[model samples]
Each structure stands twice: as structure tokens, then as C-alpha cells.
Target chain A: MYKGIAASRGIGIGSICRIIEHDLTFEARQITDTAAEKQRFREAVEAFVQETTAMAADIRKRIGPKEAEILEGHIVMIMDPSMSGEMEKMIDAGQCAETALTAVCDMFYGMFSSMNDDMMRQRASDIADVKVSVLKKLLGIEDVDISKVAPGTVLVCRDLTPSMTSQIVGGNVAGIITEIGGKTSHSAILARALEIPAVLSVPGIVDAVKDKDTAVIDGTEGEVYINPEGDILARFVLKREEFIRKQAELNSFIGKETLTADGQKVELFCNIGTPKDARKALECDGEGIGLFRSEFLFMDNTRLPSEDEQYEAYREAAQIMGGKTVIIRTLDIGGDKDIPYLKMQKEDNPFLGYRAVRYCLGNPDIYKTQLKAILRASAHGHVKIMIPLVTTVDEVRGVKSLVEELKKELDAEGKAYDKNIQVGCMIETASASLIADLLAKEADFFSIGTNDLTQYTMSVDRGNPNVAYLYSAFQPAVLRSIKNIIECANKAHIPVGMCGEAAADPLMIPLLMAFGLDEYSVNPVLVLTARCIISKWTRAEACELSDRILAMDTEAEIVAALKIAAKE
Target chain B: MVSKKMTIKNEQGMHMRPASLLSQKATAFTCSVKINYSGNSYDCKSIMFLMAACIKCGSDIELVCDGPDEEKALNDISEFIESGMGD
Candidate 1:
């Protein structure tokens, strides 16, 4: 067996199977000409329609109306002009029921494929479902397991559907090779989830391999070697075993505080999106939520959420944290995030234009509504509200005024809230970093949002694919900004935290720790690594390393020196 | 024929996840279930139609069922929609 990039983890040993390119073409559809066939077709169509209706009803019962809007595409296909017209045309052409449905599905899929919006891409699946359903009826075949083929099966197809991908469970017969699919494809997702090794979009994959040839799959690296020699197989097997052991070792440390050779303590926190993520954070032994993106509340909605509703959501998260700190970033929407109901005008350059506290300043009504919710929720447990992308000190003062306004309203109504609640600002952009000392005086705390900080410092647009690689937290300017902000915060004796991906990287942990970061909030997965790094160094050693880094002219030398100086 | 009535409840009323669940469950049955609100009636499996009706958390609607498990389907479907999606 040969070694390749493992797109996913886990081992699968199986004989190679014949590769087949999946043709999505739907033919031999039955539109039904004869009276008997028409009758059957009508019954099937009606059943399909009713089935779709009941499903929508169930969805309405769970996620709510705003989210259920996605289902309208499928509903439109089944009921109105989309599917109905296709079926009628096929019937008029005197085609069979399956043939007619297939023709209609082709037309619908074509219409959706041309649309610009990505959310509409799933509309193609609707037509595919209709074609698949009609074909299933005609062939008299029950559901086929797309996740795993029959025993001794090493099936290779062009691409897998979402439903089929979800069906894939661990311990499959063997390796999978496909010609079509990308990093985000359904087959790729399944491979990642099942931890089965598979290679995707491997051009000329079919010609090189054949049935009954033993193959090795490395889904993690997206590598598949056909008919490998003994030496190669032995090497891969050893590597796979080592990876599995390391993974298990990481899991065993979950919920345990990390401490390295030395004993200097540093708080390790996790970044979160929803209350559900709180569970994962707890599992990773996070001290508390370091950066909670709270903008999800307003993302896909026609109306603003009520204070009580927001309170319950915040309370749920607080209860999950079990009284651990939860720093909730308030109204981070601006720039890329736009809510129509909030009446945010479109800008030519959204990133450099209005966003964060800028939008909140203009729309204090909406800002106060969220403030009320956060203040009300504070009664449940430790909850801190953080404002995003703050530059000038005036913005922080303005934020305080609004908080006071809400506090007065809550006070008159006799509503209970944490009286001395803390307020913080995300030091993300260059302007914010430069004035961290001044802003630190106004705000209770500061958290470094390195995702934006790095982009801004390097003069690269993070969203632009070509420039994205240039945006690195390891850059000297980025580290300088972090150093400047930390130094400023230290001058005021206020705690400073880093909550971006850089804060979570084990390789970068020593860098931030060297900058005298009091707290590190990262993806829950990185908290252990950060804690381990922090515990090993003395405050004095870190300061020297930090000074060396600040004086460096180039980023490369600083990184190399950091590696040598940091405790292993 | 079987019929039942209830108010829509789950907080994010008639949204994506709930609609998919309703549609998936509906596909399992051979019967027809239609929900009526105001003067309009929509197929229960049509997530869009249900969502188009814009039934809020407190809105009342009638669940009408006809077919193989009319009574049983009516009871189960009614309880599901009325009990606010899932407990």
C-alpha cells in the first residue's frame, strides 16, 4: 500500500473496487399516458406532496419560522409552478410517470444551478429527490445504503449525496476513491465524520486502480495508495497508531487543568458561538467562555428577539458554564453582517466602513434592547458584555451612557442585574491597538481579536483568497501590536486577553505567553495547550522573550528565537 | 377522516430544523395531512407553505388528516405540532 495525505483519520484495509463516474442525468421518466398509468402517477404525486407537507409542519414545530424559510424551495417545487409544470408537460408528451418526473427535475435543477446565492444550491437536491423517488418506484428497489456498500465492498462513485454521507458510520468494509467532490463536498464531510480514509477528486483515480487490489486510505491527508509494498504499509500502520494514541491522550486531559513544569498560573478560556458549544468547552476543561460571538441572535430574523427570549438564551449558556465566566460580545454585526430589519445601508467597502459599535451608536434603540437583555441575563451567573472593534475612547464613553440609560430603566422597574458588571472592548484593528492604553482606562478589560488585527496590520484583506496567506499572526507587526496592547493594559493594571485563533495555536502559545498575556481565550480545543505553555514559564522569563521579540526587525528570527527560548 | 386543532409553539416557530423533521416524518406515512389557518390550507409536508402562513408561537391552526392512519396520525401529528415541536 502507498501513503497519501489523510483527509480524515482511521484505518481501512479493503480490496480496490471499480470506479464509476456518477451521471446525474435522469432519463426514462414516466409522465403516464394511459388512464391506468395516469391514475398511478397521480397517486404517487399526491403522496409525495402530502409527505412534503407533513415534513414542513414538523419543521415548523422545532426550529421556528425564520429558519424554516429554507424549506420553501422544496415546497414550491412540489406544489406550485416548479414541479407541477414539469409533471404536466411530461404527461402531455405521453411519457411514463418516472420519465415525466425526471424531465421536470432536470428543468428545476437547471434553474437553481444558475442562481448566484449559495443557500439556493440545495434547491437542486429537491429535484434530485423527485427523480430518485420516481426511479425508486419504477425499479421496485428499496433504499440502498450509500454510506456503506455490502460486505467486501470497496465501492467508488463520482460523488455522494448529503443523506448518503450522513448514513456513513465507522467500521466500513474498506477504502473509498471518488473522481468528483471538493473539501466541502458531502463525501468529504462523511469521510471526516466517520474517520474513514478516502481520497476525493483524484483525477485519473479510476484508471490507475482496479477491483481486488488491496489499498490503503489516509482520509486525513486525502491520500490513497494502491497495492502498496510491505515496507510502506508497515510505516503507515505505525504512523496511524501513533496518531490515534496522541488523540486519545488529548481526550484524557479533558476537564483537567493544564500545568507544565513550572507553576505560574494563567486562565484558560474557550471561544463559543451557541449554548450547545458550551458543552464542548466544558469537556475541554475550559475555565470559562473567553469570546462568545453573540451576533447569531440577529443573523436570520425578521423581528428583533424579545428581552425575555434573549434572557433565557443567555441564562441557558450561563447555567451550562455552571457559574464560570462568559464574555458575551454584543452586536458584533457591522461590516459583513447586515440585518434588513435593522435598516443598515449597504456600503462600497463594508470592512473599512460602518460596523461594530459604529452601528450601535447610530441605532441606540437596537443597542439598548440587547443591553437590556444582557443586563437581565446577568442575574443568572457570571456574564460579561464585550463591545467589538472599538477605536476611539469616545465610543466606550458612549457605550457607558447607553448602559446607564438601560440601568436606570431596569432600576425603575426593580429588575435585578449584576450591579458592578464589567465591560470590555475587542482590540482588533490597528487604531484600537495603538490607543489600548487610553481605552484601557475606560473599559474594564481588553481582549485581542487577532483574526482582524493580523489582517489590518499586514494590510491584507482576510476574505480575499490571494491575500489571505500573507495574513499571519506570526508576523512581526502583529506581535508588535499584541505587545503594545499588552504593555498598555499592564500600565493601567487591567487584565488583557487574546481570543483569536493565534491564542489557541500551541506553536504560538509561547509567543502570546511571552507577551505577558494574563488570559488566553481560544477554541476550546486549544485551552489545554495554552494552559500547559503558560504554566511552564516564569513572568520574568516571558518578559525577556517578549522584549527580544519586540526588538526584532524581521518576523522569521523572532519566531525562531521564540521556539528556542520557550519551554518545551 | 381525522381532525385536530392546536397552537404552534416552539420558540423559533416553523423554522428550518422543525420543518425538515415534519417533512421527514410525513414521508414515512401514506396518508395526507393538511394544516388550515385563516382561510388558507397548506400541505403539512410543504415546509414553505406552512412557513408562508407565518404562524407565530401562539397562532391556532387545524390539522386535518385523511388516509391509512388517519386517527393515529392525527393524534401524533397534532400532539407534535401543539407540544411545541419536541420536548
Candidate 2:
């Protein structure tokens, strides 16, 4: 069995078809006629453009225009004067067409590959793809057309280039395995767009499997089996059916209101990092933006983001959410997430010191810039301020006072904003849970950050291997803390939400529902799945189960009881 | 020749989308369009050059245009940059 990064969900059992790397090796020779050599290179480029244009149109029709833009970007990049003009210069100076193309491409590949940015590094791969395609066109090489592949063919390749992925006929290819790429790579993105199961970054995968070999890929588990024994195959076949059935069941919940079996309605939202992800939240049917992490505005910039720049980012998210609640967390910097420009001193216990609301309160000017941005954005939609890692009631009061001051400034400047904008605290620390009732009184709302809540409640550093066993949210202490936080918010008559991995856990959903969680904020992809889980039990039913589980003293006991009570 | 200095207003700076748009816009002019950033001049008509320049948000850059329609080119490109390059 081979393990790989699970790029897409589902199980795929099919016959393998390996796309071997092409041999574009050519000899560099002096060209007698520079004009003819340049013409040859130009013709290859023109042919590449024509073919790519057709493929882009097909992808735009089948998958989406956004995916097609990758191919279109190839067109723009290849035609750039810095690219083609340099190649023309080499060709004019007596280099062969192939040599000239390779030289220019190699120069760009080096420049992009050596960059520190991930996006620029991705461009390096893109340039490699373009070079191969144009080189193949020049060499008169014919590719094994993916469109012509038989149904149920599992394509194994070194990597799926954008042009290669564009040729994939829907429903013909069952799965894809590649030696390179991760969840965010182009190959993975294309596979998800095509609704095909894929396992990527499997070392030696192409060399391991032969053509026509029967392969079973559990993309959800990132596991692969070649020529699997009878029992294993049967088990996977059953699992595949079950996955498909569950997917169909989840699809039925899309465009429908999130409700419990006994008719208790709740909001299903998404936790996003960037403003652009708001569109994905809408696409996934998320009702609102529950936790819009504002750190991206600072992290992605070399220096502090201007108030207007931050406002634009927040406003873009607000506009995309279309008046839905967008709870923007103030810059949660310092600790493990340090911005060099901020000049944070190194600390022994970074996570416990100078983080989130603590750091924001220390740097009043930076905090005000972010607060002002969120305030300006509230005019466009239902924007709220959320303070992260709150350990004291004073943190909430500090942020609220800052918001009030910023509101007056905006009012004086004739800038519009939501007057009733909410300022909330994230109940992540043990102290926050202990004073949840007090914090709830001062704050407009509460969001339980279960990941850190569990870490702090159990005193288990998630990064420390020795105490990793105590990091589960299913721990009795963590569960009690969560229940108390939600109850405090309920008593204060303010809405409470969970914006952590636990929110999407099927086993924890009932417990959260029983605790009267008003919102469930999960990764955008899990919106429908979470809604499906939420709809399984009524408040009374969840509360009844919770009563029995809450009596358990051990984490294992609690987990076992919840698993037996799991609705899905 | 005509030139104007301004800060890049787009949050993501000169990424692929904005760079492509800027290049396409610059290619439409009859004048030569260039952006001078950190003592380096980049052709505004080339997406590669623009991206390679890495003119991030908050970074100040000078837009220079020269030729038959230098004034119009400078004004048009400057306005586009001012509008955050349609980010």
C-alpha cells in the first residue's frame, strides 16, 4: 500500500494508464538561415496557442472559467516580449529553434524557481509545462490523448500539466495519481473540479504500477493498492458505494436550511483566511462568514497594510457575503506566527506569550488600523469584530473601547459604518472558559476555538509529542469547558458559535447542539456534510445523549459513547 | 516623456491577475510604458517584467511613458494603478 496526499475525496478502483515523460532531447546546431530558424520557433508557438485556446474553451465550458484562466495565463506568459523576444534574439544569433526555446525557458524557470514565494514557485512549474508542450510541438511528438482514454482508466503521471488536465473528458477517467503536487497544486485543483478521486505526491508511483494494472485508490485516506487481494478489494468496493451514497445524501441538503430533526434552525458558516475565500464560502452554500482570519492581510504584505488597504480586503469579503455576518478576527500575530516587520522578540513559550488579543492590545496603532478597517467594512455588510485568545474580561473591554473610539472617528469623517457592530471574544483559554459568564456580559457574542481550548484546558502543547495524546477535544475537561462557554453565552442572550475542527466532527455536532451552539463554522468543503450531521438530531435528543456522555470521567469512555450515538 | 510617482494600492500587489491586466492595458498604447521600482526599470507592456519587479502593495513606484502619446499613456496607467489595477 502506498500513502499520498489526499487531493480529492472518494474511492476509485480502476485500470492504470501511465503517462510516461516525453523525450524532447535535441542537438544544438548552427543554423545557416536565422530567418528560417526563427520562423520554425514562431510556428511551434503559434500551434501551441491554437491548441491551448481550444482546450481553454473546453475547460471553461466543462469545469469553470477560473480553471481555464490557468491555460489563458500560459498564452499571456509565452507571448510576453521578455519571453518570445529573447528566444527570437537567440535564434537570430545562430542557435537552433529548440536550443533557443530551451535557453529562454531555462532562464525563466531558474528565475521563478529560486524565488521565496510559493506563488512564484508555482509559476516555475507552469513555465516548465509550457516549455514541454511547445517543445513537443516542435519535435512533432504526439501525446496519448487523454480525451481518448477508455472509461475507468486511472491515470498515473509525473504531474498533470494544465494543458494535459484540460483534455480530460468528464466521466472517462476514474482517478488520478501523480508523483508531485499537494492539495493546493494545479493537478489537485483540476481533479477536484472534474469530480475525480486523486492521490498526489506519491513517491515512485509511476514506476511502481504497470499499464492495465488494477489499482484501488482511497483518496479520502490517501491510500493506494495495486492488484489488491480479494478481501481488500471487496471491502473497498463496499466503502466506495457507501461514500457515494453519503455524498448523494449530503447533496440533498444543499440550498436547504440547516435544521435539527425537531425543527431547531441554526446557521452553517465557513471559516476563511482571505477575502477571496468568501466567494468559495458562498459556493459551498455557507450561510455566513463565521471566522474571517485577518492575519492574511498582514502576513501577505511586506509591511503593515494601510487602513484603506485593509478596508478593501474586508469590504471585498463583506460584499461577497452579501450582508451575511462576517466576524473578522483582529490581527492574531506574535507567538508562533511572527511578522519580521513587527520586530517581535523571541520567546520560550510563544503560544502562551504575546499572542492574539494580548499582542493587539500592546500595539495600539496597528490594532486601531485593523479595527478601523473592520468598522469601515461594516457599512457594506454585517461585519463584526472577534478578539482571539482572550484570557481576561479586560481584553474584551479593551477591544470594545477601541471600536467605540474608531466609530467616533469614522462618524466625524462622514464615513458610514454599522453602529450596532458587535465585538466578541474567542473562548480558547482555560481562563476564558472560567470567566465565560463575565466575558459574555461584556461581549456581544462568543466563538469557541476548540483547537486552542483543548490545548490550554489540558495543558497539552499540540506540538509536544509526549502530550499529544491529551489534545483531543473529546477530553472530558475540554468538553466541560465547551459546554460551560456555550451555556454562559446562552444565559447572556447572545449568540455563540464554534469555529474549530470540532465543529465539523460528526461525534461532536450533537454535543454542540445540546449545548445550544447557534452556529457551526467549518471548512467550506464540509458545509453540506456538517449540515447533514446537524439535521440528524433534535435538541432534546442531543441533550439526552449528552447527559449520559457528560457523566463519563475518561476521554476514551466519552469517545466510545459518542461513537455509538453518532448519527452518521 | 511623462512620469508620475504613486504607491501600489492593491492588497496582493503585482500578482498574476493584476500584472496581466496592467500588461494588456500598457500594450494598447502607442508610447513606451515603464515602471521604475527600487532603482529598476520594468517594461509595463510585459507581464514577466512586471511580475519580476515584484511591486508589492505599499511600495512606491514611478510610471514613465515616452513616445507619441506619452501624456495619455502616463495618465491612463496612473489611473489604473490608482484604482488598484482592478484588484
Candidate 3:
């Protein structure tokens, strides 16, 4: 059994289909006519650009603009004069076109790889992608299109690039097993978006599993069984049927209102990063967008987005939601999310340093621009602003004052906007949870960012592998913090919602129901599953179970109690 | 000859987008345009040269143009930089 991170939930049984990456090696030979070599390079680049542009258009129509933008980035790289100019200079010095391209691309790749910034370093992979595409064009190599693969085949690869994943159309692939990538990797995200079974970070998986070997992948369990015995294969076949049946059953809950057995209504929403994702959220029958991450708008661009640009994006999402509440979070950058334009200083401990609301508070111009955009978008649909990483009531007040000021500015300028746009605070930090009542009074609503709340309450860095085991939302301390936040919001008569990974967890859903959570905002794919889980339990029984589970001290004991409660 | 000093306001500095834009603009002129940053100068028509200069955000650089259209080239390039290269 090969253990890995279960990136997307599903069961896949199929014959292994290895993804053979073409070796990107070329023979270096000096060319006599430098101008001819330069022309050859230019032609290849132009062709590659044209090809990628067409691919981008197809991807835009099929997947969405965000995924299509990856291909657009490739076109930019091809058109980049720095790369082509360097190649021209090298060719002028009597080097072959392939050799010149390789040397120049490798230099940039090395520079990107050595960078301290994670996002910048990831650009190295993108450079490699460009190199491969151009090199393939030059060498007349054909790409192995995944869409051409037989249905029910498990794809085994070292890593999948955006280009490769884009070719996986028409449900041709059954499962994906990669040697590298965590839960947040590109492949994992794409797999989840495509609703494909995927197991990632399985070391030596490509080497261990041969082509055409029967493999059973349990994405939920994070296990891959290669060449299983007769009995095991038979058991997995039965399990696969059951999994399919369960998924069909969950689909039935999609258009239905999310309610407990006793008829207590709970809003099930989706958390989206981009405006394009609102379509997926709607398809999953989300009540609304609980957490619309606004940082992606800043991160994907080369410069600060104009107010018009931000307004257009927000308006599109609002129009799609069609009066459904779209809770958009303000620029939550800093710490892990570094924007080159912002020029934020590096900190020893970024998580606790100047980030999120702190950064917004300091840069009033940037913050106000986003606020104005959100306010303008509110005129189109149900839009609410949610401030992230608030630890003090002062921050909430400061944001409120800014929103009021922006609203007045819009009104004075005769620009149309929603007069009564709601504002909320994300109860993520321990301090925020402790003073939730105070925040509740100032804000229209409260959404528990359980991922951060768990990290803060447990005093564990969730990203650090050394202490990742301790970063559990079910921890007694974390659970207590969640309970306190919910109770405080309840006392203040403000609706409390959860917009974190924990909200999607089946084990935590009943406990949250017990706490009287008004909403559950999770990934779009989990909307139906979460609704299904909520429909199975009565709020009264969940409240009773919460009391029993809260009395437990250890994680194992709490888990044991949950198992018994689940059977009920 | 015409020359102007401008700071790179774009967050990503002289990355591929701005470098391409600047080079394309320079190629349209009849003048020899060069960018000087941190005591080093590079031809503005070469995208690789501009990007390789590694001019980051907030870094001030000088654009010098010589021959016909030098004044127009200098003004247009400066304007492009000031506009954050359309970001």
C-alpha cells in the first residue's frame, strides 16, 4: 500500500498508464549563418505562441479564464524579448538556436529557483514549461495528449503541468498518482476541480507502478494498492460500486435546501477565489459565496489593478450569484502571499507579523480602492465585505469608518453603489475569538476561519511538517474557541458561519451544527456532501453530542466519542 | 540626445510584460534608446537586456535616446514606465 495525500475524494480502479515525458535534450552544433538561425528561432517562437493562444481560447471556453491564463502566461514568455533577444545574441555569436535557447532559459530558471520567494521560485517550473514547449516545436516532437488516453486509465506521472492537465478532457482519466505535490499543489487543485480521483506526493509511485498494472486508488483514504490479490480486487470492485452509489445519492441533495432532521435550516455556501469560480459554486447549489478570496486579483497581475478592473470582477461575481449573498474578503496579503509591487519587508515570523488587515490598515490607498470596488459591485448583487485577520475591535471600527468614507465619496461623485452593503469580520485569530462579542456588535456577521483559528488556538504552524500533527480543528482547545465564537455571535444576535476546511469535514459538521452554526462555506465540490451529512442529523442530538465530545480531553477520546455519535 | 529618469512602479519590476512593452516601443523609434540602471546601461530594444538588468520595483532608471525621434522616444518610454506598463 502506497500512502499519499488524498487530494480529491473518489475511488478509481484501473490499469496504470504512465505519462512519458519527452527528454528535452538537443545536440549543440555551431551554425554558419547567424541571421538564418535567428530567423529559425523567431519562426519557432511565433508558431508556439500561436499554438498556445489557440489552446488558451479552447481552455477558456472549456474550463475558465483563470486556467486559460496559465496558457496566456506561456504566450507572454514566448513573446518576451529578454528570452528571444538573449537567444538572438547567442545565435549571433555562432551558437545553434536550440543551444542558445537552452542556455538563456536555464540562466533564468536558475535565477528563479534561487529566489527566496516561493511564488517567484515556482516560476522556474513555468520557465521549464516554456522551454519544453519551444524545444518540442523546434525538434518536431508530438505531445502525448491525455485526452487521447483510454477511459478508466490511471495516469502515473512525476508531476503534471497546467498544460498537461488541460488536455485531460472528456473524463478519459480515472485516477492520477504523482510522485510529488501536496494538497495545495496545482495537480491537486485541478483534480478536485475536475472531480477526478487523485493521490499525490507518493514517492517513487511512477517507478513502482508499471504500465497496464491493475491499481486501486482510494483518494479519501489516501491509499493506492498496486496489483491487488483476487480477494482484495473483488472487495475493491464492490467498494467502487458503493462509492458511485453514494455519490449519486449525494447529488440528489444538490437542489434541496440544507436542513437538519428536525428542520433547522443551515445555509451551505461555497468559498471561491475568483469571480469565475462563482459558476462552480452555483452548479453545486450553494446558497451563496461565504468567502470570496480577493487576493487572487492582486497576485495574478504585474501591477496594481485599477479600480475599474476590480469593480468589473466583483460585479461579474455578484451578477452570477443573483441576489445570493457574496461575502468578499478584502486584500488578505502579507506573510505567505508576497506581491513584488507591495515591496513588503520579510519577517522572521510572517504569520504573526504585519499581514492581512494590518497591511490594509497601513496602506489606506490600496485598501480604499478595493473597498470602493466592492461597494460599486454591491450595486449589482448581494455583496458584503469581510475583513480578514482581525484581532481587535479597533480594526473592525477602522474598516467600518473607511467603508463609510468610501460610500460617501462614491455618493458625492454620483457613482452608483449599494447604500446598505453589509460588512463582516473573520474570526480567525485567538484574540478575535475571545472578543467575538465585541466584534459582533460592530460587524454585521461573523465567519469563523477555522483553519487559522485552529492554528492560533493550538499555537501550531499548520504549514510546518514537524508540528502539523498538532494542527487539528477537533483539538479541545480549538473546539472550545469555535464554541466561544459561536456563542458570542449568538448572544449578539449576529449570524455565525464557518468558511474553512473544517466546515467541510464530516466529523466536524455535526459538532458545528450542535453549536448552532448558521452557515457552512466549503469548497464547491463539497456542497452536496456537506448538505447530505447535515440532513442526516437532528440539531438537538448534535447539541447533546457536542456536550459529550467537549467533555473529552484527548483527540483520541473525542474521536472515539464521535464514532459512537456517528452510528446514532 | 534626449534623456529622462523614471522609477519602475510596477510590482513585478521589469519582468516579461514590461520588458516586452518597452522593447516593442523602442523598436518603433528611429533613435538608439538605452536604459541605465545601477551604473549599468543596456539597449532598450533588447527585451533580454532590459529584463537581465533586474530593475525591481522602486528602482530608478535613466532612459537615454539619441538621433531622430529621440525626444519622442524618451517621452513615450518614460510615460510607459510611469503608467506601470499597463500593469
Best by DockQ: 2
Q: Which regions of candidate 2 fall more than 4 Å away from where they truly are? A: A2-5, A21-41, A93-96, A202-209, A343-355, A358-363, A391-398, B1-13, B35-41, B53-72
Candidate 1 vs candidate 3: the lDDT winner is 3
List per-prediction Cα lDDT, in the order shown. Answer: 0.70, 0.91, 0.86
**Which whole-number lDDT from 0 to 100 does residue A96 have in model 3?**
92
**2 or 3: which has the higher TM-score?**
2
For all candidates, state DockQ relative to the true structure.
Answer: 0.08, 0.48, 0.26
The order by descending TM-score is 2, 1, 3
lDDT (Cα, tens digit) per residue for candidate 3, span A131-161: 9888888888888878889998899999887
Question: Which candidate ranks first by lDDT, i.e. highest?
Answer: 2
TM-score of each: 0.66, 0.90, 0.65
Each candidate's clash count: 52, 0, 3
lDDT of 2 by residue, A474-567 (tens): 9989999999999999999999999999999999999999999999999999999899999889999999999998999999999999998898
lDDT of 2: 0.91
Best first by DockQ, ranked: 2, 3, 1
Candidate 1 structure quality by residue, lDDT tens digits, A1-568: 3343345555555676564433434466443345666666677766655655664454455433432343444555455433555565566677776666676677657765565533334445545755665455444445555445555455555555443443444455456677666665445555665556677777766777777777777666666777788987787788778767766666665666655335656778899987668887986789999888877667644567667656766877888898899998988886778877878778998888889889888888888888888898888889888999888999999998888888899999999888888998999989999889889999999999998899778989878898887788878888888889988888899889989988866557766666768788988767666665566666666666677777888767877887777564
